[model samples]
Target: MHNDALCNFWTSTLGERPPARPRLTAHLQADVAIVGAGFTGLWTAYYLKRLSPALNIVVLEAERVGHGASGRNGGWVVGNLAGLERHIGGLSLDERRLCCGVVADNVDELGGVLAREGIDADFHKGGAIYAAARYRDQVAIQRGYLQHLHDLGHRETDCCWLDAGQLAEKARFRDGYGGIYHRQVATVNPARLVTGLAECAERLGVTIHEHSRAEILERRKVSTGEGSVEAPTIVCATEGYADGFHDFKRHVLPVQSLVVATEPLSESVWQEIGMAERPAFSDASRLINYGHRTADGRIVFGARGSYRLGARSKADQAIGEAAMRMRRDLLVDLLPALEGVRITHGWGGSLGLSRNFRPHAILDRRHGLATAGGYAGEGVAASHLFGRTLADMILERDTELARMPWAFADASHRQLIKRWEIEPLRWLAAQAITFSYAGEEALMRRGKPLPLIKPALQRMNDYFASVIE
Candidate 1:
């Protein structure tokens, strides 16, 4: 997709956008020129400013600030790794466990970072819930949830299993068995967060240039629209919209996801349908439905990897129907207490999906040419995590936090799906999954279950695109 950077789910609704200082129209020199004014770029500049108050830093963006998937995504800031577990087949169990700890730690650290900086992006710390709808999903949750946690030796956490009665009381859902609730997830107005960091960066002497698309780059010179920037180091923070970057093309596939927001329902709406035991909640599905209620009582909901990221995808057309359907059906499916509330706004965003699912990258090819992307769908945490690391690496400042398990090297995939065709194949795969699920449901209705292809389907989802329910 062209990414349509303007139609951000979070930014569009905001009353005002941050003032654009100006675009980089002339040659400039800086200690670092961070590209892409999203979470990664902003944070890189923010942390760099924190480290050296006098460091000359300039951020270059192709569009307005927070225009990428960073500001245009579901507000869920999950502790789960972006593409972490997918690489486990090649890692020792202990190694995987350590990596998982890093993700969990990233979750905690972000809270502190936001708090310490006194930046309020409407961040809510009430945590999240992972709901189970059907028996198939329940079994998968039961099998994977606890074991994965134990293998990683993660934080002490418990799953609150609600019985049919308790489920009825906790969340006003339509129909289901029971569900699992995992705590410690958060939601925020991501646009505010990104803009706040940019403001802080500028206050600390870092310059940000918006609407300055970086077309080409070298170790010292980053080519942009009107002119180019010469810096000691060049950091690329562009995620799924890696159209012009050859190295990032294979590792990450741009996925278009849909989201919608409703006009504030009544108090009964929040008390009844919009309530989550842990505040934020998601279902156990390949193309998952994720949502949380805002402090203002509006429900902001989204789906991941639901479409391919390209101008040719149907995601744009799907938003209206998707919003209506999600509100009418899925809302009732999860909570039946309130079904008729109207959805006022509907939108979609593109995400940078990684092959391995883990989002982290740092490079300095020459003296200083670095890059980072592949947030998968968890850029909220990964973007902050890697942005700090990328900045530290650029300055040659060493810290345990900067020493991530993975770095942006020559990560590429030969069998990678092309961007132009990504959406069609992705939509096809989505239909296939729907058919598979329907077939399974039908056969199970007929007392004939395959039982074998479920894992294979999950593997495809884990490795490919999770575009189906």
Candidate 2:
């Protein structure tokens, strides 16, 4: 069990890269300046350049393009929002569906764009499946989720419920009960997608400066370690890396998510596991475990991991031996056939979590700053829609995309009640939640009744919701 902790599977798969572009040394001016060359920044650049070919755009990155979560994510292009209806309860059902439809269409648009641009990221619209592998999972699916689909006014076929036998056709979980499948999700080679988008942006005349760290961001200006960019409008697209800048501290939280990839498996093993369509999958666990079949015949599985106690945790190495072993065990537990499979890669990255839990897109014309992110763990497709929406707002295009709920410019008031408890208490609460979830899962295996943990969590969630309202 040699521990190779520092490398990311996605980047390693790309193997050998060209030298980075020269860092921004001299001061520069542009029509719009973007900080961070990850998906949010790259997508914003792509859309902006597409809308107005003559616009001068500059994207400055702290490292190489796609060096952040954009390259390390689980690769699911899901249509659901991070917060669900809790954040959008005020919108009419038609508006809510339209919002979700836009996100879903963005996934399809991404695939179309990739094909049109000739970027082979192995995009697959294989949809997503949630298996009920425990008593808690069964309850959530049989009780909570079915009603959730109904309340959302989705047709039965839109999110079909599957029994254990039907689920076996896709993937076999050790303790499979029944689950729900939604067909709007897609998967991709996240690193390839981001880098390809960056390439497209550059081709459209956008200037990209690698290793250019934006140290401070002010109205219409971004100062970096090597140089500064002055523009009429600036975009702070640094998501999880937002902590160091005090201006964005209260707006987002950097939570770590870890993943492990198995060595290539033979055809027989895949026959037993059964994801012929390459649908992304997860159990109905509150802790949120996710997996998908790779085009290279690997089963990449992951889950949220322990978080840093401080508010300013950066690219901290995440594949501790314990966490790696735990993730591997989780994969094995889901599919018992993989007990002996060699774990090829174990890695993790941080995601930007917001107070309300929904992704946000705000362009403050007064401050000349536009921001988009806080996807929690669902950023892949959302970033594209968000980028396009930001571009529409910037170009003053009166399109339907700009009319989405999150397209507003300010959220300071709504974020007030979201001010979480300070350090120790916050850390303690998170640990308690994690431990309680573990205990519940343990009890679930024995077919025990639901525990107090569920209601306790619900009450806490309800309290927060009420307070926020």
Candidate 3:
């Protein structure tokens, strides 16, 4: 599909786009100036205004609200962070559990906020199933992952093993070996969530300017083409779409991810597929894949994405025909009941990946700067927690959220977050990892016991994951 011909399934659900908010045309001063109107920025604005209704806040967006990865994600409101271990690995057991509890509770807290704000967004807390569906090797891979999660202080009640029969009761996968049933996960229609959040922030007295791209970000000022905002604090919330705005792109590289949604299936077909609980699911593959049963009876699926050579952010929603077909084939391979199902939508967007593979919410009080991002494709829920944390930090509230390990107070991110490797080296490393993972997956699919090559490739991939995941 061509860029112009494609449409995002989530946006399509919104029926029509609302009129664009006016671009910044007059110099403005506020208590806080924020860049980017996606989940992080709007969530930060929302919480800021809610916590202190008298405070003045202004939000600047390069495009429309939810136009970035916020509207383009796979819709899984995961309760855990993607690079979580890196943050909690060094903490004491009790402290690690505290952080994990905070993270796991974030899903319900987000849903509660949505309910209180009356934003439908199809919020459903059916949890998630990380299945070992394709091959026998996946069984061991999943078991190891479960152990790792437990070691990271995730509660056993929140994350436990489900045997083949229990897994089948939840989701009837092709092999259905076994899986981890994570109880703290849920899914949401991301487009609705982001748009509704922008509205909620506005209702909370936030001034939002669409199409006002932040050209320069100074200590306590942000400049657009025709206007600028000066405030006591400045926030840069542009994650994967950071582009050349300030030095954020250097710290958080943008990687492109694509997703596709199938046409609504018949009730009988759904019966054969057996996602009756509508839980999110993914197989144990290095080529990452995830999907869920939509409230509207469709299946939305996405897989591993690629890193552009120059770390360029994707602007368009459309993806090529080959990329769409590849995902469709993979989906069918995982769920044979959808052999002839038609795919209704295919789109792509960029997501931020930090050099250290850890998400952070930083407040440089000395420099009057605050930022939160590098979600690593799990921004849907993390954005909320980090946004609230940023608000608490900016408010100087001595709350537990402000004390979380991932929340850095009074420190410059440049000093804390490492910069990504320069272009060619970064691109070359990404390609090498992709090829290695593909080779490993191919060997696994063949189901032959190539003892030496398989074990060696697995070990090498594990090392790569440790470095970048």
TM-score of each: 0.83, 0.93, 0.99
Q: CA lDDT of 175 in candidate 1?
A: 46
Model 2 Cα lDDT, one tens digit per residue, 352-427: 8776676778887887888888788888888888898889988988899888777765433233315555788767
After TM-score superposition, what is the CA distance of residue 255 in candidate 2 from its true location, in Å? 0.5
Per the 3 Å backbone cut-off, how many clashing residue pairs does candidate 1 have?
13
Better of 2 and 3 by lDDT: 3
- Per-residue error (Å), model 2, residue 27: 0.8
**Candidate with best TM-score:** 3
Residue 281 of model 2, lDDT score:
93
TM-score of 2: 0.93
Error of 3 at 120 (Å): 1.0
List model 3 lDDT by residue over 155-255, tens digit each: 99999999999999998988899999999999999999999999989988999999988899998999999999999999999899877665888899998
Ranking by lDDT: 3, 2, 1
Q: Cα lDDT of model 2 overall?
A: 0.79
Candidate 3 wrong stretches, greater than 4 Å: 1-6
Number of the top candidate by lDDT? 3
Worst window of 10 by summed lDDT in candidate 3: 1-10
